[model samples]
Target chain A: MSFHDREFKKPDFNRISDVIWEVPTSFKQGMRVPAQVFTTKKLLGEMDAHVFDQITNVATLPGIVRAAMCMPDGHSGYGFPIGGVAAMDIENGGVISPGGIGFDINCGMRLLRTDLTWKDVEPKLKQLVNLLYDRVPAGVGSAAFDDAAGFAKLSHGQFREMISSGAEWCVEKGYGWKEDLAVTEEEGNAEGADESRVSDKAVKRGLGQVGTLGSGNHYLEIQVVKKENIFDEEYAKKLGIFPGQVVVMFHCGSRGFGHQVATDYLQLFLSVMESKYGIKILDRELACAPFTSKEGQDYFAAMKCGINFSFANRQMIAHRIREAFAQIFGKDAEALGMRQIYDVAHNTAKLEEYEVDGKKKKLLIHRKGATRSLGPGNPNIPKAYRDIGQPVIIGGSMETGSYLLVGTKGAEEQTFGSTAHGAGRTMSRTRAIREIVGNTRDMPRDKARAIERRKVEELVINPMIKKGIYVKSVSYSGLAEEAGFAYKDIDEVIDATAKADISKPVVRLIPVGNVKG
Target chain B: MTMSYHFVEDVSLADVAFEASGKDLKELFESAGLAVTNTMVRNLASVHTKVTKTVDVEGSDVENLMFNFLQEFVFLKDAERLLFGKIKIDEISEIACKATLYGEKLDSKRHDLSVDVKAITYHMFRVERTREGWQAFVVLDV
Candidate 1:
């Protein structure tokens, strides 16, 4: 058995509120602050023990402000738990760590709104899905779409421009509309992206992947807002989301380009961490350098390139999606009212000013598998959404429904304006494979694998089809690993966030069709 | 006979995890490489040996060497769109490893793909010398 296989006991928590649990600094040594978990009693019990260990470790990091926090969907991960949040004071001796911000930088969610309803899309759902599946490449090592439809081939100069400009480059190239950027976080182009800071290897890996949807829980889905599921009708209407209306939501991040950037920086930081800055970490994954150090600034600039790359990636996918719809319905996407609602990144480290100890301070906030939820009246939000707050997209398992939520002021006060990213995994992928396919140890290797494939069809595909949800996947075995049973209840996770007032639910969108990567 | 690799349970909730054991460092590197490749493609046999790539990487220790070695396959997948079904480790020491990877350019039609292994993560990543041989534990960000 491996060291990770060791069972950990849940820690005793002090009740802060119904949805808030706190672990004092006394619970662990070398702690600078307490750890807060925004989850219900039931979810707390279901959380992995490593979450407690990891979050406490996060609290021990230098110059951490207030408390290290985990969203309701928090789960144990390397270094920091997934759905973890930490704010490092820049003026102080704070540090920036790549582990805190996942490898897939800005791996986020995007939603497009359409005026068409279920009645309009139901008839051609399968055709639309198949076209989407073809137009947008999915799964492992997926290259860009055909040259005619994709910007897969680019000169070195052009690649640098795209990485620096992000979705802004797409809009200028006619791949997206100008209005789409307004609703997007950072208007689809994060500030301070320096092409020189990014490595040639990262560029090579990201060059051809602009329009691709990579594998592993990443997907593009057609969903509908059922009339009854609309929670705040006023906010939904403000966001241009109508009951029964169809929308397209997809999740991905800076593909290999981002991975390489994180890897390169982690290696560099690890080399200089002890001798250059004398920072010690409980886990090697928590490698870091002083926020003001040359290494930290370099990584930040390079990371922004990854953030911009994802914005471009999702923007290109949105273009292909619009084309697919237009080809299917024989009407241009504009006439069909294909407008973007919002695009939000769940993994990132951004420098923002927040009131700390009653003084406004600039802090580099790292959100790993957590979404930024800015409340109303924030200047960072677009003009159209300033009064309503940022739109927070929380995707659930494909079988379960996803949600459209709005940021609340409570999030700013309690969580540094952060919220849960998704219905966090409750079971491992291997566990899902075995539990769904049943025992096949006696069967031959190929035969056992075949049974697993068949079980995915019979148990996952067939049932989904019966319920009128059309699915197109590159691999059935990959789809089996994402079975709905492998995740926590989305509704429960949403309830926890709402009760905590970190985010307010707007609409619950059920999947009508899916293109799984 | 020693097992080359086996999927581990109860480690990571979202990503894939596996433990690979070999009688020596060379075998250990081979088994670990296969584990990384196998996580992406369901059947290595489906990826025909149409291409061969020579891999050379160095690290400070066994753990770092293993990390760098496994990353080669991940980098190949993204940089060249290549998949290696077979790994032949010619040399492996505490500080370095040299290997040959044999596979083909990914053809979605022929390859039974599973998930894109985004990167080899250091979370719970370990490599150690055991009583009989060398064993490594790896968790991949899929």
Candidate 2:
């Protein structure tokens, strides 16, 4: 059989509506619902077999509602698959699975707008980039205070406070401005967080590392606007953006705290799930427990801790950036218009009300490698952005362009207020190192990198990695994934969504410089 | 003299019944903290801090003591901008001890910020002994 056929059989691309395609449950056993993948021929060609399997696996989970939907950047991941979205009803025996949340918990991204444009600070770009890089900790176990950020940092008391307070803790400690909290996702914290549920190891890992940026696909980038006026310039100006102006965008998350949360739950669920609920998982990574169960409550509470810690982290980084800017410019960052635009979590599971069967129902939505792209006038949205809707920050690679997009009403009918996070890797990191890295054909890692070796070296040192790495000898049909060249051109993926009218672009950002650990 | 160090991929988890062997509980806790820091960055000598902050941590037992020590690293890294450098064992006891670790504010131009350790995990995590002194595997979650 063709490698694709063995893994995916035939793609049941039955376009159910204008945008949704249904892969019926008959395609795979144990599927509670059908998979609704949002893509076209153009986008489908860019996806791999594993992504198909991931979508299928998600549909089979207990208490899953609607369709096991995937965004445009869908790729093979642990249980839920990156770019995959599924909603489970809490009252209907809905199960909370670690695979749904992934190991990163609330892995997310944020964009900060500054009054000073590239033209205003072009002369001082060198100083700004260097300073930001120096202050923020990066790479593995790269906690802010600890030499080795691990489970030890979280401990008992500190871990409890972080989960309960969310970003308020950081604000109380003066790491960020009080006003900054208004524009953040969930007001920079989740209310349901109960630290009592988190394990001792998870607590120690999180306690002091709340504000640090860890490595492996996590980064801080200093980028420049590639093009403007894709939308109204007046709005862009209001967002503190100008053509050729410099902007800072960062991608990091709850660090080891979240990883431990998902890891601990994955292991716990593995042992208790089948025995307690008679649930059989399609993938070990997809281990789950009923939402009403003790295990589920504990995981949710602990996951909230990770979510809040991430908000605290980004908040801290923002404060430090403001300080650095003030030190150099001799002016307060706020006075200079350096404030947060919006912060969004990409990988997470949340309770949200979306229309189902022409009625609004509350469901737990798990979006891995997908950002919530809520539209305007929703009570959940901050009042300031009510006119324009929530700003969706999509982070591309260091070499490619990141985007600022606004959610549309059309997306509500299509996606559950969600959009792709980035150029989902077609190739695993190991494959990238072996095939794409050090290769002449690969694009420059970034404009500021003196040599490409530094980026490649980091990839080599990346630890705590996971990949199925299917063997051809065992299956004769596993050929599509390798790394870099495997993904479709990211710009094209964005354009496809644009054509579908899912999200309209505001600005495209190309990385001028970046540091990846 | 600078020395070439081998890359210990999974240092936090040992292969065998490799646990730290210290005569006293204080020694065991101290060794646990040391084991964790050494596993993360390349070497302690490469890190230094002119700024000094005192860490006074006490937990009920050996396991909790290790927990407090890990929390200390997190506190110092975020608020003080100090990454752990070296461990100076001043006093050791069943419930508490004093250790002075060396670190400085993060300087990108001057020093490399090696890794953003999210937290340490207890997967195969333990304090153990080596022939030279005391050693333990501290599995770090990167």
- Positional deviation of A379 in candidate 2, in angstroms? 0.9
- Give the best candidate by DockQ: 1
Over A150-199, each residue of candidate 2 has an lDDT whose tens digit, in order, gives: 42255467557767787787788667778678888899889888877777
Weakest ten-residue segment in model 1 chain B by summed lDDT: B1-10
Question: Model 1: what TM-score for its first chain?
Answer: 0.98
lDDT of 1 by residue, B1-142 (tens): 5648878865888788999999999888888898888889877777889999999999998898889989899999998999998988888789988899999999888777889988888888889888989988899988
Model 1 CA deviation exceeding 4 Å by range: A2-4, A439-446, B1-3
Top model by TM-score, which number?
1
Proportion of native contacts found in each model?
Answer: 0.75, 0.18
Q: What share of the true interface contacts does candidate 1 keep?
A: 0.75
